[model samples]
Target: MTDTSRQFVLGKRPDGKPDRDTFELEKGDVPEPRHGEVLVRTCYLSVDPYMRGRMRDRDSYADPWDVGDRMGGHVVGEVVESEHDAWSVGEFVFGEGFWSEHSLLDGDDLTPVDPSLQNLSLPAYLGVLGMPGRTAYFGTLDVLEPDPGDTVAISGAAGAVGSTVGQIASLAGARVVGFAGSDEKVDYLEDDLGFDAGINYKTTENYRAALADAAPNGIDAYFDNVGGPISDAVFSQLNVDARVAICGQIALYNDEGVPTGPRKLPQLIAPRARVEGFLVGDYATRFEHANDRLREWVTNGDIEHRESIVEGFENAPDAFLGLFEGDNIGKQVVKVAEPSE
Candidate 1:
């Protein structure tokens, strides 16, 4: 057993895009679990776009991380010590905990991982068969509700959730168009992911014109992941009775101040479109159902997934900072420590 754990803590709030100084790495004593608690050794740590919202000192969907406190997110870890009878050593579990080598977790906060549940690697539980996949499942099928032959467009389409949304929509028999940051990502969406078309938002000079050309019949379903000019283009291409699922706004996540963009409500009015912002946690009761489906989809070649992993717990901060830079193609996670055999 180790007494020291390396962790990152909030150092200062960012004015724009965050950097290494935004976090401070420190070594602290490993927390000892009391009654009804267990000590976990982290194997992976997820760094997501939503984490940026928590960095702010304002009221939002999630609480802000206090300065000097241990930064935490979705952590997949192994039970190394247990003070609770319900948990045993060497068991794999997922929970919200600090970005450290080890953490003390309450039994209620932990979800046991069934190694035989899916054929994907253990780390797959942190991505495709995990939160991002589940978000895509509900956002595309449940919220957007695209139909056969309909054109479905996704902003931030190369990203974790957006990629999954596109694949799911394609599976539902819709023509999928994706707006990504790079030509390489555009190729990934079209060539590798089976999307009908992909637009490189970064390289395109006339986004609206490009989108209009791609979906001449108009977009029947829109999954908004990057809310900015790219989103505006998608809004302009909406068809009658279109459903728009607001999954994320990563485009404006690192803005220095409140971003003022073109108002798009007028675009939706005549089209009679429905727009809703959704959180994956809202469907918590049905997570198992979603994961099971995602597992089957990935395992059977019906769906494909990718990950941008930053090796070592030491570089976790850099991995998190890279999200705003669009450095990753899919789900971004940090490999902290290898799980025990």
Candidate 2:
């Protein structure tokens, strides 16, 4: 076993968009596992849009990480050493671990990875079958619950959550329209994911007009991943009894202060629309059931997922910063190390 573990620490608080200097790579000796704990060698580290919100020193659903603190998120790793009877060496598991080559975690918090599923790639545990997939599943299926023939509109349509939302929405027989940042992503949505319409929001000057053209039936359901102007446009098209799933506000994640935009509530009041914000952790107790359904969808080709993988542990920061720059077409993950043999 290797004696050293490399880790990334938060070197500085970001002013607006995070940069390379925001993280510091440091190496330390891998700690011996204590009783009831296990040592894991990380294979895949997840980079999510929500991590941007946690970078700032502010009150939010997740706690803020201070400077010099270890950056942590979803990781899939192999147990290298286990002091707990419940876990064993060579078993792959998933848990919230720091950005490091190795992690020591309590056995109670981790769930074992299925070796059969890992045959495709360990990265899947950090993306599709993991948190982002569940977020997309619950937000679209549970929150909005679009009916067959319902016109459903989504923002951030090429993203991990948005892409999954589009696919699942299509399966539910909704007329899916997605708004993406680039023409390539728009094509991926409309041509590859089977979305009914895909709008390039970055190039489109009139969001309301684009939405009107796409959903002439009016939007019966909305899956919002990017907020601000796109949301404003979507609100104006909500059909009566419209439902909205507020997933992420990535458009406002890097704002220096609260951003001002046109009021959208007025559009909702008359339509009796519903909007709700949710975190994937809120469905913890039911994760097993959710994972089962998602796995079945994936195995049966009902849910198609993608990952823009960064090659090394050292590039984790670059992968994270790339989220704001729209560098990835799907879920982003950093390969920290190869799995234990």
Candidate 3:
């Protein structure tokens, strides 16, 4: 095993969108696992839009990262050494791990990756079979609750959570309409993921007109991942009793102060729309059940998943910044290392 390890720390908190200067990569001795802890060699690191919110000094659902603190997120790794009975060397595990070549995690906090499910790649645990997938499953089925023939619309539709939510809503028999940032992503949503219609919000001059053409019946359910003008457009065209699941709001995540937009409450009143914001952590106790369903759908080819991987641990920060630029098609992850055989 290597005697040295490298990790990234928060160098500065940005007033707006963060850049590479916000991260500091430092080298140090590999940390040793203490009693009841396990040492893991990180193979894949997740880069998510929600991480942007965590960078702020203000409090949110997730704790804010203090300046100079090591960055951490969901990681898939191979256990290199273990002082905990539940884990053994060579086993793969998933847990909250640091942005480093290696991390020391409490065994109780880690979930063992099943070797029998080799049909799916290990990175799947960081995406479809993991947090994003479960978030989509619960948010679409439980929150949005689209009925058959419902016209469901999603913003930021090409992203990890947004893409998965679209597919799940489609499976529930909803005519899914997606709003994405680019033409390519719009094609991906309609042609590849089977979305009923897609609107390129960046290229389209009028979202209301686009929605009128795409979802002429008006929107029955809205899975909102981006909160901004796009959401404002969706809100303006809600059908009666429309269900809106407020997930991530990446559009305003980097703003310096209170972000303002069109008044939407009055519109909601006319539709009697139900809008509820949720964190996937709210359904922690039911994760196993959700995972089983997601796994079945994925393995049976009922659902298709993709990953946009940036090679090397050093580029983890770049992968994260790319989220804001809409650089990834599906899940954005960093390939840190090859797991030992």
Candidate 4:
């Protein structure tokens, strides 16, 4: 192991969309684990849309990162040093880790990774079988609850969470319509993922018109990931007693101040639709169950997934910035290092 470790810290909070200047890379001595902690060498680091929220000085579901604080997120790594009874050197684990070559984590906070799991790579735990998967699971099964024959619409449908939600809803017998940024992604959703129809929002001038053509029965369930105009269009086409799962608002995440759009409440009133925003942490107790099911689906070919990986720990910030630009097809992850044999 190297004596020096590199990490990215918050250089400054952004006024609007963050750039390379927002991250400060620093090299320091590798940290040692105390009792009940393990030192992990990161293999894969997750870059997600929600991390943008942490850049702000204001409070939200997660605590804001102060200037100079290390940036952290879901990481898949292998233990290199251990001071904990449950973790041993060379074992793979997943947990919250900073954007660094190595990090110290409480053994209790880590989940052991089974490298031999069928049809899955280590990065899968950071995407489809990780937090994004759990978010799609609960948000679809509990919040959106699409019924058989229901027409379900998803915004940002080609992304990590939204993609998973579309598949699960299909498994539940719903006809799925997906809205993505490009025709290529739209094709991926329809041709590869079995979405009934796909609308490339970038090319389409009228969202409601495209939606009407795709979901002629009107939308019975909606899994919203990218809010804004797409959401406004989805609201206008809601069927009676529709359900909307308010997941992430990626479209408005980088806005400088409060963002205003068409009012959607009045549309919901006539439909008597139920809309609920949820955090995956709320279903923490059920994660193991969700992971097991997600694994089974992936293994059995019921669910298909993809990863857009940016190699190197140094590119972690760029991987994150790419999320807003729709540079990834599914999950965006940074490959830091390979697990040592």
Candidate 5:
């Protein structure tokens, strides 16, 4: 069926903080899928902090989005039409769902989402069960291997990956301490999520003091999400042989360049701490195991998650901007279209 849908095109590259002017929304005809491809009616589109890096014209671990190109993101959708046998019509799939109402994906690019979760919100595929979930899974268990009772500290605790990390760490028998931007987030981590300790870094004048107050035993494992003063504080408070999982540097994403924080490599060296950076995409082969475990946790009530669902595909640009400002409580997702039965 011929379809016309609205999609956001990157209007201009942002030098620093992105504004709505940076994106231009326009309507376009949904092109038919070629052989070995499927037409996915985009149900939900994810808005992640990582997408900010893509909008900038700079060198990074991931490629930048070209000018006038559709904003790239993860999306959960139904197979409206399929030219490939593997992807039948009405199949739920997750793949590169750009900021659009409908998307085309090669048979190789799409991964089938759990059919049981169809009745649930589609954004859950982009949040707890998707990249964010996988990131927290492997990043904690694999990258930051911690023993029972190890003191683990996580920054950006209110965010998708950070929230998942705290929950997983608590389940893994670690004394979890989380730092977030607001008092509400801190309350969410400590009261709602059962984190051992929570601190609002935005209120605290000294993060070092806050870390010391929360984690008296020193940090055994650090999940570095906001890489700024908070990171430096955690680095300084690391115990001997601590492991640091370098996730997204959300603090620096909107800046013109990497902000200069206190240099603390000496602290890492003295303690022989291992700091490792990770991307969930690198662990795609093992995602099944991670998802299986995450699914079990969710099923058993060991893990609880939230999603910031923004209605309308046109609101994608606003959702994307909200990430940097910490406006989203949990996983940020844009509802592109209703799921097709």
Candidate 6:
């Protein structure tokens, strides 16, 4: 195999909002596999909001990337060379290959994908059948346990995880309400995804009124993705014994310091609402269980997925910065080098 590579590097830490200046594109030598590693030709790279936190200078649950380090995330690709028998040449797999054209992944980092679905497209492995789907599954089923006839509300309802959460709640017999930024996104949620109601938060001045109009009985469960004023609004409306799952907080990721807001601890105390924070990585033990159920849902048409794919590895930084601008309708991915079969 020819030795060639392209990778995205953190150019500088963002002062407030991230721009293209925050990233740098570079060419590099394709890595060779070590004793327990395999060389993977990158197929598709996942560009998630969480990557924003990783770009920061402070410590997060995940390690922060230095100014010149290659940015890391999930990728689905094919093994072209291997030093480990568990992954052989021509096999499709998911690995932490990042924004590079090629990567030497450790044995434990790769998960083999069924080649029978190769023509179905492997990028789906980075979205619905992978991490985001599992985030929705384990977060809702395990933490929320939404009951039949319950009204479930999801903020950031148009993104990958939020969209899946709404559909899963609907599948489990709950009345679903989705909050998104645009009429187009809200419309898709209501018309296609089967959410009972969709609110365009960008256009609405009174979010509480809109939420109340949609869920007359108050919210029984809330899957919060963007935490800020929206979460505070939802917090004040929880029904007794309501369950709230704290997922991603895109609204707070770029903030300069502790965000100030109206105190809402009273609402939780009054209703006995259970608000729990979860990191999807912590649920790895049951990933197979969640993956199987998500695959079954996809096969049965019970779950739907969409992707906002950017064309090149060089475009990863812009694709990532586009998240805060609401440029992606679903999972944002950068397609690097095509995997060799």
lDDT of 4 at 106: 93
Model 4: per-residue Cα lDDT over 1-341, one tens digit each:
89999999999999899999999999999999999989999999998988899999989999999999999899999899999999889889999999999999999999988767622688888889899999999999999988899999999999999899999999999999999999899999989999999999999999999999999999999999999999999999999999999999999999988787888888989899999999999999999999999989988999999999999999998999999999999999999997776
Q: Write the per-residue lDDT of candidate 3 for residues 61-134, one digit (tens) a residue.
A: 88999999999889999999999999989899998999999999999999988787754688888989899999
lDDT of each: 0.87, 0.90, 0.92, 0.93, 0.87, 0.87
Backbone clash count for every predicted candidate, in the order shown: 0, 0, 0, 0, 0, 0
**Where is the poorest 10-residue window by lDDT in model 1?**
116-125
Q: Give the lowest summed-lDDT range of ten residues in model 4.
A: 114-123
lDDT tens digits by residue: candidate 1, 1-341: 77899999988887778889989999988888999999999998988888888889899878898888788788888899999988999899887888888989998778788777523566677888778889999988889888899999999898888899999999899999999888999999999999999998878999989998888899899999888888888888888899999988888888877778888989989999999999989999998899789988987999888888899999999898888778999888899987776
Candidate 5's C-alpha runs over 4 A off are none
Global lDDT of model 2: 0.90
lDDT score, residue 329, model 2?
88
Better of 3 and 4 by lDDT: 4
Query: Which has the higher TM-score value, candidate number 4 or candidate number 6?
Result: 4
**Which candidate number would show the highest lDDT if scored against the true structure?**
4
In model 6, the runs with Cα more than 4 Å from the true position are 339-341
lDDT (Cα, tens digit) per residue for candidate 6, span 1-341: 66778888888999888998988888878877889999888889998899889888879899999999988989988788899979788888996767787878897778888666577767888888889989999888988898899999998899989999999999899999998999999988998899999998889999888888999999999999998878887888899999999998999888879788888788899899999999999998988888888888887889878888899877888888888988887788888767664
Each prediction's TM-score versus the true structure: 0.96, 0.97, 0.98, 0.98, 0.96, 0.97
Per-residue lDDT, model 5, residue 216, is 90
| Model 3 regions lying over 4 Å from their true place | none
Error of 3 at 228 (Å): 0.6
Model 5: weakest 10-residue lDDT segment is: 115-124
